[model samples]
Target chain A: MTPESNPILIGSQRVRVELIDRPIDRRPLSDFIRDPDTGAQAWFEGVTRRMTGSQQTDRLEYEAFTPMATRQLQELAAQAMDAFSLTAVAITHRLGVVPIGEASILIGCSAAHRKGPLAALPWLMDQIKADVAIWKREHFAGGQSQWVHPQ
Target chain B: MNCQVLLFAAARDLANSERIDVEVPPPVTAAAVLDGLGRQVPRLLPLLPACRLAVDQAFVPADFPVSAGSELALIPPVSGG
Candidate 1:
């Protein structure tokens, strides 16, 4: 399905997962706010780095099976909330070309304690790496590019 | 009947197309669909064994029975964080 037709796969107002074509603003740590009762906020960002183990990368191109990706993302977000006893969680992933230093994927979670938020963010990232349908292609400085896949 | 299998990323570049349609007989299992695709596009055969089949937007095993006209996609090992 097209991005416009991509459904908002939300478990609730507290859990938000979305795929955006444009750049993501990490300033707000996504649209998730630190409500009055929430005592901690944790964020994890997957940025396009210039060096990927020595191969200089100029940018990254991300492609996703939108329908399935969004669905899985929503499921992951909801699970993170329950497992971590979180107040809110938001995940935003970028699609298309992303220049170096831009955040390609960002996740933010709010919880009652620092430990929960800190623990949950890394766990959530692992799930995305294992199951998410999005793919990342690295464009090297020499103009060569290749998709990142299983070894 | 025939079903279309959507391709993506490295698989897409290898197949040289966004999708491929294959003739699948009755009792359309995920394996049957992959076999059909491999016969039609030999280039994609290498990736079939390593890939998972997504039927109607959900991951299914090779023997999983798929209904006619359900959307199918070849999902390679993903790398995202």
Candidate 2:
């Protein structure tokens, strides 16, 4: 119901992470926003982009070392919760070949005020990119593909 | 003893094999298994530094002991959402 009602686990505890070839559910946005106590529910969804600067992208493929990736992501979420005092936080990352405009990562954080979740969202994303055991391959229209390294 | 090492993501793709059974001397450590893996799958050399090892879905440190019949997986850096 409310973000406060759904408290996320914190610390070096266990968390759930799965790798599926199917599409991700977009309902979490509405679910997280339905909280009455949440003064701000900030969400960031990473979708496959069709272009990057002057380069036109055809599609993208994602791969992950599931165990390590899951562990890292859980750690990030836990840290964010402690640092920001977030009410609810959910992150779902899709694997495999995701076409253009499809969601890759869905990050939601709800807090009593806008600043906490707002600040935590970008920080969490940066941590995920820096530490998580995930990699991406960008496929161009000319049948060339390159592994996208972490920035 | 021989234990199967499961590979995932880039490790799996580079090794060209999903799983490999590595034989080692008694009382092996996670590090030893990784050493054996390096010899078995030379392509994994570049990935070892960034790779992490897990036993039955739980991440373990390199010095951790490897029991007989344990299931180990070599997890390369992931690129998921």
Candidate 3:
């Protein structure tokens, strides 16, 4: 499914999850998950770093099984919301080539207290890295490229 | 039964193709298709044991029953930010 076709559901709270082919914007996502009653909000941005195991990376090419990746991401958001008692949660991960210093993934959550959002962000990130149907190929400056796999 | 297995990431690179079709005997299973893939593309054998299998978008075990028209994918250990 395309990015625009992605859904944002609302019931007890809002949950937005998407797989985009462009850059990730943190502010809009942060605002999307904001709630009037929320006492705190947490935002996490994952950027493409320039180094990997002594190799200098110029950029990263991300590929995803779009349909499955989108489904997994939505499931992750729902799990985070339920597990952490979050009022709102949003996750957006970028596809295609991402240059060093560019944000490749954005995760935001809101809760009535700080601890919930704080703990959920990292947990969600780990889940995304481990379970999501996405892959990254690091392109090094020396014309070498390698696929990165989760440990 | 005939089935197609989709490859991704390292599995894709190793197989040198996006998808592979295999014909199996009755009582088809994900493991059967994976075995056929290993025979057709020897390079995929090293990654097969570690890779996960997904049938119609959900992860399934190696012995999970598969049908002729099922959508399958080989998911290597993922690394996403």
Clashes of each: 0, 7, 0
lDDT of 3 by residue, B1-81 (tens): 777889888988987899988777767887787788888889988788778889999998778999767798989889888
TM-score of chain B of each: 0.91, 0.89, 0.90
- Looking at model 2 chain B, report the run of 10 residues with the lowest lDDT sum: B72-81
lDDT of 2 at A6: 22
Model-by-model DockQ, in order = 0.79, 0.35, 0.85
TM-scores of the candidates are 0.92, 0.77, 0.93
Ten-residue segment with the worst summed lDDT in candidate 2 chain A? A1-10
Candidate 2 lDDT, tens digit per residue, A40-128?
87889899999888787899887766655666777777778779987767777877788999988888877789999899978988888
- Candidate 3 residue-wise lDDT, A1-151, digit = tens: 2233265564665888887888887777877987789999998989999976788999998989888988888888888888999999988888889999999998889999999999999999989888899999999999989888755
Interface Cα root-mean-square deviation for all models: 1.1, 3.4, 1.0
Over the true interface residues, superposed, what is the Cα RMSD of model 3? 1.0
Which residue window of length 10 is worst by lDDT in model 3 chain A? Answer: A1-10
Steric clash pairs (candidate 3) = none
Please rank every candidate by lDDT, starting with the best.
3, 1, 2
Writing each residue's lDDT as its tens digit, candidate 1 over B5-66 gives 99988889998999988898877899898888889889987777878889988899889998
Pairs that clash in candidate 1: none
When summed lDDT is taken over every stretch of 10 residues in candidate 1 chain B, the lowest stretch is: B44-53
Fnat per candidate, as a fraction, reads: 0.78, 0.38, 0.90
User: Candidate 3: misplaced stretches above 4 Å?
Assistant: A1-13
Ranking by TM-score: 3, 1, 2
